[model samples]
Target: MKVYEALAAAFVEEGTTDVFGMMGDANMFWMNALAQRGVRQYEVRHEGSGLGMADGWARAAGRPGVVTTTSGPGVSQLATSMLVASRARTPLVAFCGETAWGDQTAAQYLDQGRFAAAIECGFVHLSRGDLAEEVVQKAFYLARTESRPIMLSAPMDIQQHEYEDNGPYVPSTQLIDRPRLLPDPSRIERARDIVAASKHVVIIAGRGARGSDAGEQILRLQKRTGAMLATTLQAKNWLYGDTDYHVGISGLFGSRVAMELLQEADCVIAVGASLNSYTTEHGYLFPEAKYIQIDTAPNLVMGNGAVADCYIQADANTGLAELTASLERESVTIEGFHTQEVRRRLTAPLIDPSEFRSQPDLLDPREAIVVLDAELPPELDLVLGSGHQTDFGTMLFQRSREITSNYGMFGAIGQAPLITIGSIVASGRPAFVVEGDASFLMHLSEFETAVRYGIPILVVVMNDQALGAEYHKSRAKGLDVDLAVIPTPELGRVAQSLGGDGATVRTTDELRAALAEYVRQPRPTVIDVRITRDVLSVPYRRLWFGEDV
Candidate 1:
């Protein structure tokens, strides 16, 4: 067997069924070999989009995503997506081809290891055909354990060499050990004491709380301690409808009432959350709250630069379950944060009632989001894009399931559409990618990839005819907003030209009709909802104009 074929067999042994990437000379042989072994291949328009798709697949499917790229420029194209995946801590294994061995004069000859290191991604070089399976297994092991992207670089020349048959290949799963660490007895007692003593307490959960039964434990703890529930932007709607005391998302996208309640917290128990600057509002969200963090890596100082008073070093599930048990043993049930008045405030509408002046042929983004939220099927996975429009979707749109992902971690736009494609494939369901016009145009060519693959992804473009954030920020500064405004092409027509359905809507009724048509037909569609640029999102208004929501 050739080295490339051996690598393909190793990938299959690791149970990698779905792979995403564009084809190139260096890696085409291995990619073809993998395809021949029944692995699904998703060809993307760009290597960056392929990496984004892999990241999305990892998040949605709860497994390490796989992608392949050729040498040189193909590997360079992964810089941004790799950094984003590293920052988001998404597990992904990328099979990147290096230049031919002993051929520095080759066109694609570049130091792939330095590039991977610059992006903070783990790199493993496959130097020997005999060690191919071991290298592939190590790549998977690192990705699974570190929860970060790992690139396995195989040289083009080496890939063409014959490989010695190494008996049966062992998958990384056998070597990987992930144990749920229980919290220490002394630390649990300390956390329990803090919870019992505080008057108003808030429990903020993050992505780590997902898939661990931590949400249920958190709710049980809430009942025992009368703590209000909130989630970070990544974990939005996690605790929704589970309790009357739950206050939606907490952070820059937090509602006015949620922010107010968070500010009033006398103690905060963060479970599997990083307590980052945005989530804590730059250390001002919980001014008087004693911070207690529970996670595998407990830190003395939080990501917001505040000192944690207590840290329980354990997994979210084991730690929270033990904390709840400890509190229950002491019969600690406080009743201050979950009052009837608080319940009313928690369930109240998040959107501002004040109206913006009506435009001639545009819908208010906020109102349009609420309409779309109501009209779209609840089963469709939602992928939110970054920019000024994200806050509107984050605050207004509600989902019945926890199948929501976003491309805002690195504050990068244009990834949501591609990410939505991977999510749709992973979940085997329809998905809606709520993105701004500027963001949508970034990877608009990928819509053709969706159409070719028959992926059911609906791209809902908030057509504001400009970079909404830059335009609003320039307007706030009394500068020339014209510089930020870019006259975009008709996005609906663009999608239709790419072999997908398209609809341009100017009213809420039109938006509803477009969504209904998508649900009925179930194909790749783009709904260009022209929203007015006159009104600013609540979060943007608060940040730029200091307007209280």
Candidate 2:
């Protein structure tokens, strides 16, 4: 049996139903073999695009994702998406080809291990054909357990070698048994005591708490304890309902009420949350809250103002369930903890009641967000760019009851267009990519990938005609704002020229009319919305208006 063939078979044995990649000399044989074996193969335009697809598929499917790319430049193309996946804590296995063993003279030859390490991705090289099975299995294990991307480097020579078949392949579950660590009873008791005693409690869930089905239990606990409910940006809609007293997002992009409520919290039960500086506002948001951190692995060493009064090393679902049951048995109820007034204030939309302050001829970005939030199509997955616009989009785009496809982990501005296209292909769902003009221009060609492949993705370019964040920052610092401002060409026209649907809107009416048709029948579309920069972004607004600051 050929080593590549055996490796492909092993991938199937490990339950990889779909493989994403581009054809290249070093990896083509294995990819072809995998496809021939009835495995679904998605040949993407670029290796990075394929990697982004696999990452999106993994996140949406709740499984490990696989991608194969050739040696050198091919693998290098995966650097950005792989780093994004790693930072997002997505379990992704990238099987990359390497130069033939000891063949440093090859044009595409490069040190694959160093390449992987440079991006902080976990890398494993195949030294011998005999150890292939173990290495493949370890790749999956490391990817899952470590919550990182694993680059499995297979040299062409090694891939073409005759497989030294070993003993029967053990199933993945039996081979690498990850323990489902539950919380200690005494620690649950301690957390329960803390929650019970605190007058104002806030239950904040993060990425680790996602997919745990802990929302119901957390809701029960919140209602019984009179505590408010909130989510970290990554865990948006973790509760999955339009409940009152649910202060939408916490931290930098938080609703003013959410931040205020958190500030008032005497005790906070942070489930599966990293409590990063962004989430905490540099340890300033919840100045009064004593945090009870619940996670599978509790870091004993903490720094940089991580607030963990007590840490429980347990699965989010397990710990939260335990806490709920114990509290119920004790008949703990904070009946008026979250009052009607509080709920009304927290759940209310953040749009200014006063007329939208538009910049004369421009569509107010704030108005766009509010309207998008109100009229967004059901089940639309969001692919948001990283910028001042996203600060609005993240807070306003609330259509999905689960996580959005985008995260600020890598924080690259231009990646969203490609990432959005990849996600639409992988998930087979209609998505909206909210990009600013600067971000949209960076990868204008990737939008063509959507049109070329006929993927149903609507890219909404918030055309503020500037590097919006930097532009606002320069003004804030009393510097020449023009340095950050860059004029943008009409993007909709470009998209239309590429055999796709395109619309440029400057008014709410035009946007609404455009969306009505686009949502009903989502072709590969780009809606270039010219927006005003009158209202400084959420980040800029915080400098002058926020109490947490």
Candidate 3:
């Protein structure tokens, strides 16, 4: 068997059924083997988008996701998004192909490892023989253990080189223990003290609070202390449907009541949330409230503006249990008169209208999302990739089910559609990707992959033909904004060529009809809504700078 063949099989053993990438000659052999092994390869339009898609998949799935790109420009293309995945600590292994060792004198040769290392990624070179299996094992280990990005560079010779075939190479099953929950008892007492003393207390859950058994503990603590609960967008659904005290989401696009409650609270306990600049309004999100921070990672405490009265480096669940026992010792009621009222405000339906007027040339993605949400079947799962549309979907697409996203520091655009495609296939549920036109174009070819896989996915492209968010910033920076504007083929035509339905809607009625028809078809489809270039829906810049919109 060839090294490429073994790598492909190893990836399959690692629970990867799909890989995202752009094909190039350097890695053509492995790509072919990956296809033959029944591991579907999603061909993206850009290398950056391929890495972005992998990062999104890992973040949503809570496992390592994979992507590949070939030598020279192909490998370089992945730099931006790979850095994003690395910083966000999304587990991803980008199998980048490098120029043949003999071609060291070639002009196309670039130091891919140097770049990846600078970004804090685990960079490995499979530039030698007899190290393929070890490299693969280390790659997976670094990816899962570090909870960070890892890049494996396979030179052309190594990729195609023949290796002695063993009967079956079963990978080692040993993995490091998952992050544990260890609570500090003294800190727990402090939390109990605050809960017992305050007439009104609020619990704000952040991304750090996710996936740990601690979520249930928080719920119990809420019930015990009569504390109202709110979650950051990243932590949405950490608490299941409609508990009496669950406040939906808080921040720039959050409900007025959510903002007001944070304002009114005397004691604010932040769990796992970094309470970064935007979430804190650069210090105004909770100006008057005393802070209590609980996280497993101590470094996060100092970074997210937590001048904690009590900081606990404990498992959120154990921490909560300790706090609960302490509260019981202090005779604090786990239930409250206002807890139900807080839940009522949180569960209240959002009635915010699209802020921008939709002109004939441009459409507001929020309005487009509203129309699509109304038209699509109510039961579908919605996962948005990061971009301008993520901001739009956070506000507009209100579904009862959980909305998952990769809000990691990577902030890569053009990866959402492919991620949705994989997620829909994996989850066996219809999925929707709310993406911007520029981001849509970034991985537009993946529509064909979605079509080939026979998965039903609805990709709503907020097609303004511009990098709406970045262009605005570029214009403000006095850069030539025109360079950011991309004139591309009509997205509908591209969709049609891929054997999928495509519709470009200029109005709400057309959008509704198109979405309804696409839903009925039960196939991959793209709904490109022409939004105005001047239309700004979420006031992203205003929110970023903590400006009153």
- Which is the leading candidate under TM-score? 1
Which regions of candidate 2 are displaced past 4 Å? 164-173, 240-242, 300-307, 398-400, 405-407, 543-549
TM-score of 3: 0.86
Candidate 2: C-alpha lDDT: 0.78
Query: Ten consecutive residues with minimal summed lDDT in candidate 1?
Result: 399-408
Global lDDT of model 3: 0.73
Give each model a TM-score: 0.97, 0.93, 0.86
Q: Is candidate 1 or candidate 2 better by TM-score?
A: 1
RMSD of each: 1.4, 2.4, 3.7
Least lDDT summed over 10 consecutive residues: which range in candidate 3?
A: 539-548
Model 1 lDDT at residue 399? 53
Q: Tens digits of per-residue lDDT for model 1 on 1-549?
A: 999999999999988889999889889999999989999999999999999999888888888999899999999999888888898898999999988876889988889888999988999999887888889999999999899999999998899989999698889999978776878899889988988899998999888786565878898888888889988888888868678887878878888888888888999999888888778988888888888899887465776676688899898888888888888889888996888899888777776546644477798888888888788877777888888977788887765555455636677788788778887888898888889998999988899999999998999999889988999999999999999888877778888999999989887778888889999989999999898888888788888889875
* lDDT of the candidates, in the order given: 0.86, 0.78, 0.73
Per-residue CA lDDT of model 2 for 150-242, tens digit only, reads 999999999898987776775455666667888889988888888778889888888778767567767777778887777888887556464
* Top candidate, metric lDDT: 1
